[model samples]
Structures are given as C-alpha cells and as structure tokens.
Target: MKTDGAEVLSKTVTQDEAAILDAWNVALLEGTSLQSGRIREAELQTQVKTVFGQLRDALASGGLDADAAGFASLRETLADISRSRAIQGFTPTDTANFVFSLKEPIFDALKRMPDGDATALAAGVWAAGKVLDRLGLQTMEVFLASREEVIGRQGQEIAELSTPVVRLWDGILALPLIGTLDSARTGVVMENLLQAIVDEEAEIAIIDITGVPTVDTLVAQHLLKTVAAARLMGADCIVSGIRPQIAQTMVHLGVELNVVSKATLADAFAVALKRTGRKVVRQQASTEGRR
Candidate 1:
C-alpha cells in the first residue's frame, strides 16, 4: 500500500544516511533548548543511526503503518530514546522534536533520490511524515510517563532525606520533623525512628515538631501512631514543640497524645537526658590565689 515509503527508506538507509543524519541533527539542535549541551554530537549520531536502522527495517516490512506488529522494534527504540531523554532532563517538546525534526531531513533526502519522480517523491514524503508524526506522539507519551516516574522517585528521596533520626546522646535519639505529618510521612517517620532505636539501642526519642505549621486531629493521630511504634521498639517518645495554640487545639479536638509532651525541643532534650540518667555539666575554673 505504501510502496513509496519502502522505496524512500531503502534509498535513505543505503545511500544518503549520513547526509540525512547531519540535516536531522541540525534541525534537532535548532529546536532544542540550552539543555542540549549535555548531549554530544557523536552520541546523537549513534542514536540517530540506531533509530533509523530500526525504522528502515520496519518501513520495509510494514510501509507507513508502522504501528503494526512488524514495527514493534521501531516503537521500542523510540520509547527507549524518550525515556533516556526524560531522565536527561529534556523537555517534552524537545524529546518529541527528536523524532518530528527528522521529517524535514527525510523529505530533503527523498528529493535527492536518483529514481525519484515528483509524484513518487511527494507520496514518499507524505507517507514518511505520517509515520513520523505517529512515532512523535508515542515518544511524547513515553516521555511524559518517564518524567512522572522521575518526579515520584525524587519526592520519595526528599521524604527519606528529610526524616533523619539523629543520635543526640547514648541511648537518646532526636527526630526533628519540619513539615506536615501526613500518613505517608508518618510511616516513614515511624520506620526511621524504630530503626534508629534498634541501631542506637536508644531508650528515649524526642520528636521535635517546631517546624510543623499546625496541629490538627489527623496530625495528632499520626504523631500518636509514631509514638506507639517507637514504644514497641523499646523507645519512649517525647512530643516536643507543643505550642499554646496546638495544645489548645488538641484539647478542643479531644485528641489525647498518650505520650509525654514538651513545649520546646530543649525542654524535651532536658527531659530525655534526665530519663537516661545524664546531664550536661560545665567545667568550673579552680579558684587559686595568684601572687
């Protein structure tokens, strides 16, 4: 049905592949942002060759209907390119342009075909454009999906980074939470605190929520759950940063924090030190008379 596409692919892959690649790269870089500096010319040429080889084989077998089973390899190659570009911080438009920009080069190459007539060349260009447009859309879909995965993984990393359990002293750990305590973050908080307790053989944990903007029923519940989990791990928890507003709100909401509460992290730390039978003492200078 699309004999023109077959002819175009056969000729381009065999004769003018290098020229088309050069033209395609010019178009790609022109459309790309400054982020393209991360990609080198040799790497781009290698990828172009790989993608064109697959597309040539697919077009030979399936003509312009490259979405058929015969073109699975071509689709797979495009998807891999999209995913790699996404991880490399390429924009969606830039990634899709990697395929779309090839249209101009392909049409230009078709014009240089020795046996190409005007009508035949027009047919070939149209067929190639249609297939590339479809592939461009597929690339965009994969790029968006990969970018979303990257964002989700980054969010998880940030959550893990923020919820650090620090050893304040022997048998004492401090978990300073600095944001909203949702169910997800609560789970992380609990896991980190419990693991730290086991690793440090900690007897006391101080959860300082001075950075938490508000204290509501749900937040209170999450705190309680963390406290319960730590107790199970043989670590008593002290909820610090109990501001007057939060304490009053907890009372009105009838949220009972069964664990001990303190008004500040220092107060909680003092209590933790006392519970662990420790105190910070200053060294006093000896009062000796000097002649």
Candidate 2:
C-alpha cells in the first residue's frame, strides 16, 4: 500500500514525535500561509534553508505531493521540521536574539497577507504586540518600584537618626510638601529645620517659600508651629525667598510674627548663627584726627 502525502507528512517515529511534528506543522502553516515570498530574506533565510533542505531529503526519501493539498502539507511539514531543528540547536540567549531578529519578518508577514486574512492576522499581531508592550512596561515599572523601595528604606535609615534638614548644606535632599497647611508651611518648615538641625547639627535652616503661595490664618498658624518646633529643637529656621505679595498679605492679615524670628534668608542665617552662640564681631577703626 502507498502512503498519501498527508499520511507521509503525518508519519512519525513515535506518538510524542508525531504530536510535536503536528504542532510544528500547524504553526508553520499558520505562520507562512499568508506570508509573501518563500521567506524573509534577512532573518528567515535560515528557516528557508532548513525547510528546503528537509523537502529535498523527503523527496529523495520517496515522499510525493499528489495534489495541492498534499503539496501544501509536504511544504509545511518540511518547514516545521526545519524550524524545530534550527531552534533546538540554539542556546537560550541565542533563542532570544533570534526572536528579536525575527520581529521585522513577523511584522512583514502579517502585512503581506490577503485582505480577508490580513485583518485577522493583523489583529492577532496587534494583540500580541500589545501584550508584549504591556509586559515590558510592567517589567520596567517593577524595576523602578524596587529602586524606589531601596531609596525609601535608605531615607528611613537616616530618618531614624532624627537628623534635621539643615545639615543638607553639606548634601542635597529634596522636600516634597503636599496638601494645604495653615500658617504658610510653618510646621513643615519647623520640622524640616529641626531635621536639618539634628542631621547636620547646623545652626541654620533655609525655610523655603517655594511651597507656600499664600498666607491665610491657617497658614500663619502652621508657620508659627514650624517656628516653635525649630526653636524647641535648637535650630534657627531661616525663612527664605518670601515673595513680596505674600509679605503684604501677612501684614494685611495682621498676623503678628514677633514670637517667630524673621529674616530674609541672609538675615535669617545671621540670626541663626547668633542663636547658636556664633556672633559676628565687627572691628571699629580709630579716627586719624585723634593723633
């Protein structure tokens, strides 16, 4: 009895081999059926070579393609066998590189399909692309999240020391203040100063106005809280970069700042040094007329 083309293509040494061969056949047929040309010249040439080689071997072994269906079956079976053998020899890294290299060919294959098949093929490719993109984004996000966790943990370590933000003169630390506060960033101001004080064991903290845009009653309260907190921690929180408008608003609001030591950044630093027992002694010159 003579075996038909489909039967010949379907034959295997074992059931497991048959299953593997069948799966490869399906994948090759599905992947290449709509592709233009025999194979993509750049990346898929190896696949082409493998398939052609296998077909030659099969032909020499007396495999016959009796009809169009039989011919297609033989062609796909050969392609599958070739692709599988080629992949089998690849190391994991090589496999990854190979896949990466195949991206263009894969895309081209989808683009060249017949109109009826194009939509379905394109849709499948698009879906696959989306899944891959999402997976890549998630991977990057996870990596960044992990890095943030490490930085946070490091921050907690320093925070444990209760070091104030003032010490940052010798280093850099970003303070991201969020939400509305009464007294115009007073508490945060104080907390940052005190943290600086403890951390740097410094006499001055530059109280930043970048975060505070207004001076309402609540703003004043918070500022007072910050000042008080700084004093208690033995740090002079220097209010810096006060906008002219904000200062006017403070005056109009009639908020007394007597209890809170005030200065433009420079004066604040001078005051800070004074409070920390560092005085700037001035030298007086004697008049020549006395001689």
- The lDDT per prediction is 0.84, 0.45
Please write out the lDDT profile of model 2 over residues 181-268, one tens digit for every residue. 5432344445655665677665555555544566677766776677577667765545554567877888898976645334355565
Residue 3 lDDT in model 1? 56
**Which run of 10 residues does model 1 get worst, by summed lDDT?**
282-291
Alpha-carbon TM-score of each model against the true structure: 0.84, 0.35
Sum up the clashes in candidate 1: 0
> Where does model 2 exceed 4 Å of error?
1-104, 107-192, 199-219, 234-243, 253-258, 269-279, 284-291
- Candidate 1's residue-wise lDDT over 1-291, tens digit each? 435556665666567878887887788667654345868767877788889888777776756776798789889988988898899888777788888888888888888888866777877787877889899999999999999999999999999999999998899899999888899999998888998899999999999998888889899989988998888888899989887987888899898988899999889999999987887765555645331
